[model samples]
Target: MWNRPRFDLKVRLTLRVAAISAACFAAISAYFLVTADRAAHARSDSIAAIVAKSLELQQGKVQWVANPRSDFPNLDPVAAYVMTPGLCLAFRGPGGDMLQRFCSGAPAPANPPPQAFAAFYRSLFDPGREAARPVVVRGTKLGETVVSVDPAVQTAEAWHEAGRLMLALAIALPLLCVLVYAALARALRPTRMIRTGLERIAANDLTTRLPPFDLAELSAIRDVFNHLAQSLDTALAERSELTRKLIALQDEERRHLARELHDEFGQSLAAIRALASSARQTAAQECPSLLSECDGISRTATGMMETLRGALFRLRPPDVEELGLVASLEGLVAGWNGRSRGETRFSIRFDGAFETLPAAVSANLYRIVQEALTNAAKHAGATKVSLELTMRPDEIALAIDDDGRSNEPAAKSGMGLLGMRERVAALRGRLSFEAGPNGGSALRVVIPLEASDRQLLDHAA
Candidate 1:
């Protein structure tokens, strides 16, 4: 019966799906960036090797080429064909230094790239883009031609693209999530309506009906929810009617029992007492021992009558039906105070029109207050007990507090509290136990006052 709160369905679904998508996107993006970068590196290396081979075939390049600036310009056609953006073709002298004059299709760097930048870029792309070969033209040796391109620019460009891609994803993920959340909410819109219906049902509105839905699944759910509410309503109505009848029968039975005990056992004891008294008077003149025996019998009869009186009071308080609820509760508390005998101080207060209440209401209130008083006297070890019966315009409130325990009530192990709850619930009332201001326990009960016709209608439905 206890329902703990959980996140909304749309939000939970959106977040879960968004997280999974983000993970998958991240993996795919990394793989794509890596593959694209490797493919670029391989293309650059292939172009460099082609340029070097072309240059080697024409110039007969070998380990050494004398006066390379004057001779290696034959590579202009090869450089024109091979060079692209971020691609640089260079011919290196035998000493392994760039020949800027021979470079074409790209601006030459002012100096050889720093070893550190090359080493880092190589690690990310391809490390072996440098190409060198000996030119053997007609089996004759010539200086070697080396062709190379640095992929650092390509690496920087790849990273820039990656950043742009990440930025796009960052912006789009939320928008996508928002769209998804809206869709989910729309799809589960009936669930929200169903939840509202359930809440109304929880508040005892069995007449609550879910609206028709467009979706078949939602329509089915609505039908089921409506049916369940109807069934519960019917069941609870039957149960309440049964309870009402049982309570009426029980009260009648108690009244009958009380009357029987009072009329039969009460008269028998009274007659025995009168006969014993008369016998004692007659015997006192002739035999004193017989008079003493009559006196003992009279005392025993009086004791039995007293026990029967207590039992009758318990079965049904005599004044409750005669004097009404307020007076009955006051008398009950007065008895409790007397029993406590100054160990616990007691107070009773009533406000508003305390009479004219229905018989069932009066009976339940009386019984519930009786139980509360007995519990306070027998269990609560407080020095001060307070009882209040307040009649508001819409409801009646009863509050009983003691000054014994602090902050918490004693464990409810016995049937007294449970029976009290049942009695209060039978009258369509609310009961609660809380910590009293003075460290004792407070018992509060509220029973709503409905019109007689309305009460009957509710019971019938």
Candidate 2:
């Protein structure tokens, strides 16, 4: 099933880093932005303060130019007036002509201050600008002079610088993000490798190992995966060994049972048959009632012999180990047909190179077929059965099908089915069961001899 993105550690880390980096970048950039304009304004304020002090020194000494019409931008007199104790007024036109338009109101000026002028006028002189110190004017005192300092140029420069800074940040942030992403991915390379290695391990491929990622932080995780792979390999080896022993034990038990049934039970039934024959022969010389009793005894012994024979056949089957899986399956079909009601039909098919199968594979294929047939007869009200043993170059396939109304419960647990699964697992084979067409069941097993080393080894043995 596909899952949506939820809270994951890696994603959370990435988001946190991005947030912090963006916030920090924004804060620093904003600081520069604000300071850029403020510093410009401060320079303007400093110039204004200087102009105001210069004007205060020129309070009443000069005739104050009374609105000068000449547009000669003169700084010398303006600077000189700043040194005196009187109001001083300075002006410059748009053409950069400085004029001392007014002093502190000796009378109204003949020409008013230029309607459009830009200038810096100061009320006092400071020794730093090398102007005359303010001296006491012997005349009447005048009102304080006002100074104006223009900072249009400085303000524009400040804005331009701030724009450049913002532009640089805009251009660089995405690149920074890209670089950070790459560095983080590189730093986390070992973790990705570990994840991939663990995935392969989960898929039961233990032949591959993760490389040594020497990061001290991740060293423990590396060791854990390596240890896990080693443990899995050991477990798989032990499981294969156990499966081998179990198969061998099962073969031995089958052999023991086959021997016991053939030796003890077959002999006892034979002796009983011989005794019954003798009784029949002896009863002929006796009375008619005795002869009838002998016939009943002989008939009972014959039936007993047949039952014992059938039991032995079930216990041992035919020479499956000697003739291989295909012949054994054919024998099984014949036996089933012989025992089934005359109404039931049976068929068997063999495909591929059946003789090339390994013995263990052959055994598993036969047992699967056996279990399938037994299930069909017991649970499916089958009137016809079909079995197939198909071998390919790479795999061995067995299929048993029946044409009958299924009588097995839909979902109840059954040992017969469980045993089939266990047998397939032990052989490292695969089994599938499906409802057959026309209301019956189909059971199949496909064992890949090349894929299962243990099966191959046992078959070689």
**Which regions in candidate 2 have their CA more than 4 angstroms from the true location?**
1-17, 60-166, 180-200, 214-220, 262-311, 334-351, 375-414, 417-461
| lDDT winner | 1
In the range 1-461, model 1's lDDT, one tens digit per residue, is 99989988788889998898788778876787678767765675566567656866556543356655545536677766766644555565655565542433444444445566456656866743655555445665443555444465555555556666777789888998999998987888778788899898876668899999999999999899989999988887777677777767877898899999999999999999999999999898888889778999999999999889878887778666689777787777787677677887788888766567777788888887777766666666677878888877668899988776543243243456776777776766778887776577888999877777345534544
Tens digit of lDDT per residue, candidate 2, span 46-114? 533565444444443233668544433334545553433223444433343443444332333333333
Best-performing candidate as measured by TM-score: 1
Cα lDDT for residue 363, candidate 2: 71
Evaluated against the true structure, the overall lDDT of model 2 is 0.61
Candidate lDDT values, in order: 0.72, 0.61
Superposed on all Cα atoms, the candidates' RMSDs to the truth, in angstroms, are 6.4, 11.4
